[model samples]
Target chain A: MTWGIIGTWRMVHDGLVAASKMLQENKRVGDAIEECVKAVEDYPYYKSVGYGGLPNEEGILEMDAAFMDGDTFEIGGVAGIVDAKNPVSVARALSKQKFNSFRVGEGATKFARLAGFECGNMLTERARRTWELRLDEVKKNNLNPYDGHDTVGVIGLDLSGSMAVATSSSGLFMKKAGRVGDSPLSGSGFYVDSEIGGATATGLGEDLMKGCLSYEIVRLMGEGLSPQAAADKAVYGFHHKLRKRYGKAGAFSLICMNLKGEWGVATNVDFTFSVANESAAPAIYFAKMGQNDTTVIEPITEEWLAAYEKRIKQPIE
Target chain B: MTWGIIGTWRMVHDGLVAASKMLQENKRVGDAIEECVKAVEDYPYYKSVGYGGLPNEEGILEMDAAFMDGDTFEIGGVAGIVDAKNPVSVARALSKQKFNSFRVGEGATKFARLAGFECGNMLTERARRTWELRLDEVKKNNLNPYDGHDTVGVIGLDLSGSMAVATSSSGLFMKKAGRVGDSPLSGSGFYVDSEIGGATATGLGEDLMKGCLSYEIVRLMGEGLSPQAAADKAVYGFHHKLRKRYGKAGAFSLICMNLKGEWGVATNVDFTFSVANESAAPAIYFAKMGQNDTTVIEPITEEWLAAYEKRIKQPIE
Candidate 1:
């Protein structure tokens, strides 16, 4: 059997690595623990997810997150958490705490702080100032405040054949208050199944949520489709439905891993995500958006991924 | 007074040249009409507003178009017309005849055939036979029919202070029948006014219609915004909204001419559209999507305009 986990945000990744280490030592699943730990510590940029993300129009860093364990079908999520240093921790808490499945808004932020996270000061002073100035500019221009940039996610499969997926995002910068995108939404943002595969999404949360793209991707795999086909179908279906409603806007980037150790990736726009496989070094992939009609896929090198990882971990003094 | 016409299809350019000659001899508008007519006939592949465009999902070539005489807002349009040898004629008929607009569908095709244009049978023996072989290969791999592809369009203004715009597309190839895109929809697909400017859109039709992006661009021009600024705002608004709704699936390319005899162009993706002016020749500008986030602008060249004028006399075969 195999087990895995996925998440967005560096802090959350660290926490998951720590937790997985604890579980590995205690539960005696020894083979894949090193890779899982390494994946978390290897990749950095959480602008799309986690507390360090760029703030919205209000100069507040809000977060959305979810975690799922394929073996147990256990899921945990939190949305609209403000000043939470690591929103994924809340999702982890929910998954580990049993009774807590979800949380939202100020309460979730408070819980994270109480749980020993560094909260209430997630944004650096410079970011806050920039956010304030941009907010005013957006207001003057009559633009939406919440149109933030990206989302983050993590997924994994363990040695015992269990899988997990997690996601987080700051939502759109300058979005309306209390706006929840697909990040913390179950099924839409995160899905995991040890017998099939696991998938998570970032960008254009509402469209991903409305179409239930993540879950559908996993479900498609369960129906015996290849990982690539599942990813393509999921993205295509979401686009078709979205075209019927809002036209087009952001993008949806996804990573899925099947039971046999195969992986698939799909997206409508440029995206960045990382992965770690047994016996291989952790790596991140950056897909650049192209000008032509076709969507081309490319992988970022290990060197770039390592450099980015260092950048994310460097603390502001 | 100044008068000019803009067209997007390969043959429509020919028609515009014929019309320009007629108008100059009978009406006396000079360089503007000559340049406008020339711009249409020379551009080999204006995907959004021309013939032989990339087909929609059904592999059928459908067209959307509009023309505006800035002096009177005398406009004519036809959307989703398939099998017509020259959709521009139908659009001209709408302006010249009692009816003034038509939507894409079988009926539109019938009207074109009845009006003496050659209408090719859709998915007849040859097309079906080709599909049968291709479908079997795709089905063997369990792939869905609808995927992703590009669409096309055209817009222009003349020296006589009159403006006209037109557009066409084959819709998405292998698409479900009865799907109408923004091409045929007024305001969404194309808009023109000598007092303000003229604009036309291509890409995701649904988003263009929902946002009324073409009209928005023109209105921005009316508000005294530079054509570039107006186009940027309109495209940005539509892009943001669409991302919020469905992720990013569509884009728009536009050309605008202000009353001051200045021209503007904008787009959200990598695409191209050409313009001809009294002082210069018709020149084609290519915009590469995602390479530069900001829009690019340049003045038309005199030599290009001269060459453009030379190509406008004959009917498009």
Candidate 2:
């Protein structure tokens, strides 16, 4: 069997590297997924996910996260979690709780406190700066079209053919207090069935949730579609149906994997994701709408942006 | 064109009847759904859902609710909402919000306050008595096998072929404070699409979320499975996969409809849901496992339990 890890964007480069090393050392996919998510949760550079991340309109940090064990189909999640350092870990804890598979808000915060999770300010200076800059842009009718930037979804395939997925996010910047998106909801952000495959999504959570994007991809894969085709169809549907309601609220991007360890990605917008297997260094790849070819690899270096620009050739509107 | 409403159990009979009345009066499906959910949220006798219904282990009334407009595919939800008298209405408000589609916890509470909702004690005397009695039973290792009872899911289809679904819950009885279930999550407790129809679910939220139960049923219906057959397959799958990890925590139940106005219900366990159409009074129907035929209607009477007993002929255990 083969093993691999995939995540959204170069921002999670460290997380991808860690997950790759764990797989290289023959760790279980569950452990690898948790490790990757935990690493990303600690990385302050990314404003949309984990500790020290973006805050809501009230300047409060409320996060959402979910974890799924592919073999057992056991899933746990927490939404609008405040004062918790690692929502990903808190989600893992809730997953193992006997009577509850999900928690939210004050209840999530209280549970984390009882579970021995540290409570403190997760806001970093970097996030505050980004929030202020974005707020100014919002006032000028120039909203940031970076809804996809708010999530760090990690999927791992172990050598034993098992899979696991973890998704964590601080959610939309300056969102209404208590606002929740697709990050913590099952089937919307992440879904796994060991018999079929696994899927994780990044985009506007509202769009993803309405389309049930991740689960749709996994279901399509089960019905004999390739992971790439499944993802393409789901993203296409997400964009198609959403435009009929709200005009172009960003596009969904997805990374999908089947039981055979084959991985693919598709997106309605120009986007990049990181992939790593035992054979090589973790690398960045680009996927875009209407692309004929399925997957392409690029070095995880300075040339990455140049290569992505060449691949799409069109400016991001 | 016709209009109808369906909900879990007799406790929601009043709500279903109200929704039917509104539809008969030419109200939109969206408005009818909201009205039904609000009625359930106010009813007091039911221990599993709505205001003054039940409390978590910490004696908190953390509620979850969602509203979906089938034609538009727009969804709004709030989880772990506290001190809001009508979480269903709050969820409706979130559904109409400009940017965010969901909110939870303190944030949900704050939004509800801003939206002109009354914030007060939602607990009542009957609920306290139930909690005390249930707590005693729980201490004796007699857990309430009623996670399914946590939700009041309502689906409405108007004569115009439009559909809408609303789900609300006080959440699992004596659950961890802030615990959330299938009610507020799209594709779990409810999912609707104008072209394909809609589905609403009740049961273990975790199992439903992992299986994407409601969405699966709707998809099966889309693939030409009759509503009954589609619900059967989804319930069967929900039971099959969940049993591999947790033994018999109560199987999921689903109610499905197609654009043609045909409806069906299915479950792994014996279940009875309330239904109301354009004609006649709100009624009760039975659907049991291992039956040759699915969907049997019975008189809506005081002897619902005894009539259900006659239909199943098998003990719940």
Candidate 3:
């Protein structure tokens, strides 16, 4: 039996390690994704998601998340939801319904409450201080406030051959209130078909939504391209086309895993991800755009990991 | 110069005819979409869009709308926004921004107010009575509460050879508060590229979001397929596969117009649409699913138009 899991960013590594064990034991795809994403959401130091995620311009902490069951094509999502400790868990619960699966703002927060999911203030003291400092800097220096848009996107394939995908983010740091990124959007943010494969994205939500790259990659995989080839073709091709047509393209990253337990990744900027499968242990890798529409991927280095750990935990002042 | 415009449902017929005149005049794609969509929003007799539209289970007139610029690939959308007299215009304004193009709920409503676009309560007296009756019937008979989810989706190609797409809807009748549908989603409800073509959809947003059929149709057009072939292949193929995978496929209809002004349509259930182009005047057509995944289309009969006009304005008890 072959089981696999892949997620964007270094933050998801520990969660994937736990979910990886569940997959090996033949747990279903739905639970595997929720457990993995919830771990990222609950962590207090990941500044782009859940507990410690940065706030919008108004200093309010809103979040976006989505869950999709590749087997049944059931999709549920929430955007601009607040005070939900684990937005991914709320998304998973909503996926069971036939209608009203995607909710936003007050509705999404209320669902978390009415359904008896865990709820608490997500804003951390460090996060608020960081937002205040950034707000002051941006105004003083006339700096761009759009930053820290990473979303924890996970793709899981179980021993039963079922696959599922989920994504969660606090959206662009200092974004306008109620802004929704591609993290909660289908096709752009995530797409999976258990019979074919699954793909998820993290990056500039605005530009990512312009090209439904996740859906395109899965479609390419279904047409017989390997996951690597599909990621290369879909991601690089659209990145080039978008620059030509739209005059500029924003940074974005994508990862995919096919039904055979093979996986692939591509990006226009530096990206890190963790993955594990039947043949490999959970490991983190860093990738960057390479020459000729390719991606250069390597094992995460000790120096980079150590630096990241130090930076996230640095003093707020 | 060649020009074209197509929109979902007979409800858009009058609006399309008015916009057809502007398309021939070489107006920009942005204003053309807003003008057409706003007409539908203002017509109080229409019960599924803008003013006079059906409300959610809570009897709130929440609305969803989106606008996309094909040349630059800018997208703006709003979901669960309340009391906006013309959500399409607000979406158009948001598309010009580089960040925070999509907003939801209270934030969306606030954006409309802050931007100084028109605002008013959207629920009509007749719509409120209909909601009351439906609520009573569902409680007494235990019938399905989901119905009347048609969205006004428009695709416009102007004399300048530019294309754009827009959509507006009140979402599913009696949906849970803050429920969102495909109308505001990028690849599901609508997609456009001035270099290739544009497509928009109507019917069940829940089923529609699962397929990303709008992007598929446009991509097929990019591959040199005629609009008719693209629509037929993308819509019918997904419809067939979805039923096999998910056990049932909801009703859906799609309409497309290529850059050259050629157009096509496909659907899984009975549908109606209005189209105009360099070669054809604005006219409504009826379509139905035919044998072997083809769509059978015929000009709308005068009797059918008369019946529709009467049905929409009929009194609600």
Candidate 4:
């Protein structure tokens, strides 16, 4: 049986491995994709996704998430939702509805509660301390507090040839109340087609939404481009075009997988991602821009893993 | 001078004519696009946009709108906003921000207040009466209350070679609180590029976002297809694909204008729209799906106009 899973960011590596094992056990695409993302959401170490994720400017841990089923083209999303244990699950449930599938703010919370989904305060003491320190740092240094937002996006292709994609994020740290990134927005944050493939994005959502890079990558795959070629053409082409048109482009990274279990990635900034397929076991890789509008990727090293472990667990102060 | 304006709905005909006069006067693209949609938003008879729009299930009138600048790809949007006199104007203002450009729910309302934009109760007496009657009808006849959602989208090309697009809607009538449609979404609701032109969508936002038709139309235009061919290929093509994949497709209409003052439109249901250019006077036209996956367009008849006027103002039962 051939099945695969690919996800944005190095943080999802642990979850992808478990999900990949489930795929090996013949899990459904939607269940496997949700499992991959929900694990990351439950982990308290990742600061840009769920639970311990950073808060907005008003000290609120608002979240965004979306799920899409490739076979039915059913999509559901939530923006600026708070106190949800697993937003990916909420999005998956919403996808089954033809109307009111996408909700925002308190309305999203209401839907979660009315649907009998578990809820709790998502803020963490460590996260709160980090927010305080960051606020002080910005006040003292006069620096931009809007930086380092990484959305956990996972795409899964099951043995049944079904595909699904899900994304979750706490959004840009220190963002204004009710501010939403592309994580919950279709085409911008993610797009998947079981017959062709799927793609997802992370980085500066304000810039990512401007290009619709995720949909473009999938369309290219459907047109017979290899996953690598499609990712390169879509990401680099848009990165250059945005810079020329908008004067400068913000950082963004994208990953894609085709129906054949082949995968690819591209980014304007240094990025690390995880992937597992029939030909490869779940593993992390680092990527960066190369010469001639391409991406250079290499397997992650033990040194990097050790440092990341220390960095995430460092004292809040 | 080469300039033009195209807007969805016969309701925007008056606004399009006024904005067309401004475009002829060498008004900037952004200003003209805003003027076009704001008119419909302020009009009481246009119950699906801005003031006097239908309320949600909770009886609160929430609005969604978006603005995009073609030259810079700057986009700003608000979803589930309330009591805003001109949602398109607020969206246009948010487009100027580098961060937190998209706001939702009460946060969107708070941003409007902080920005000093005008505000008023969007729910009108007539709209309330209609909502109450619709609720009764749904309960009595077991009818789906979610019907007749039309977003007013406008695209403009100015003499200075700039282009912009804006969309505003009250979303699906009798929707749940905070339910957002494609009106506030990028790529789905609107996309513009001075080099390639722009496209905006109306009708069934939930289904529209699945195809990212606006981005696909602009992409097709970028690949050298004419505006009409692009619209036909994208709209008709996606309509069939969605039906095949999702088992059904919803009503949708799209309008596009290239950089050369050329325009096109396609729809899956009965639709009316208005357009004007340097070569023609502003006029409303009717469109519907034709044989062989094409759009049939013709000038609106005087009888249709009189009937529409009577239909909007008839006493509620």
| Docking verdict class for candidate 2 | medium
lDDT per residue for candidate 3 within B68-152, as digits (tens), equals: 9999899999999998899999999999888999999999999999999889888999999999999999999999999999899
- Tens digits of per-residue lDDT for model 3 on A21-50? 999999998898899998999899999999
Chain A TM-score, prediction 3? 0.99
lDDT tens digits, residues A80-141, model 1?
A: 67776556666666655322345555446656776786665666654565577776777799
TM-score for candidate 1, please give it.
Answer: 0.43
lDDT of candidate 4 over B1-317, digit per residue (tens):
48888999998899999999888888898998899899999899888998889999888999999999999999999999887899999899989988899999988999999999999888999999999988899999999889878999999999999999999999999999889999999999999999999999999988998989999999999999999999999999999999999999999999999999899999999999999999999999999999998899999999999999999888877
Indicate the residue-level lDDT of A14 in model 4.
86
For residue A28, what is the lDDT in candidate 3? 92
How many angstroms is residue A59 displaced in model 3 relative to the true structure, after the best TM-score fit?
1.5
Cα displacement (angstroms), candidate 3, residue B2, comes to: 0.4
Every candidate's fraction of true contacts kept comes to 0.00, 0.81, 0.74, 0.79
Shift in Å, residue A202, candidate 1:
0.1
TM-score of chain B of each: 0.71, 0.88, 0.99, 0.99
Which runs in model 4 stand beyond 4 Å of their true positions? none
- Model 3 has a DockQ score of 0.84
lDDT of each residue in A156-270, candidate 2, tens digit only: 8888888889999988888878788888889999998877888998877877888788899888999989887788777776676678765555556888888776777887766
Each model's TM-score? 0.43, 0.91, 0.99, 0.99
Which digits, one per residue and each the tens of the lDDT, describe model 4 over residues A1-317? Answer: 58999999989998899999998899898998898899999999899999999999889999999999999999999999999999999999999989999999989999999999999999999989999999999999999999778999999999999999999999999999999999999999999999899999999988999999999999999999999999999999999999998889999999999888899999999999999998899999999999998899999999999999999999876
Runs off by more than 4 Å, candidate 1: A1-46, A97-100, A113-118, A139-146, A288-295, A301-317, B1-317
Output the lDDT of residue B214, model 3.
94
lDDT of 2 at B178: 80
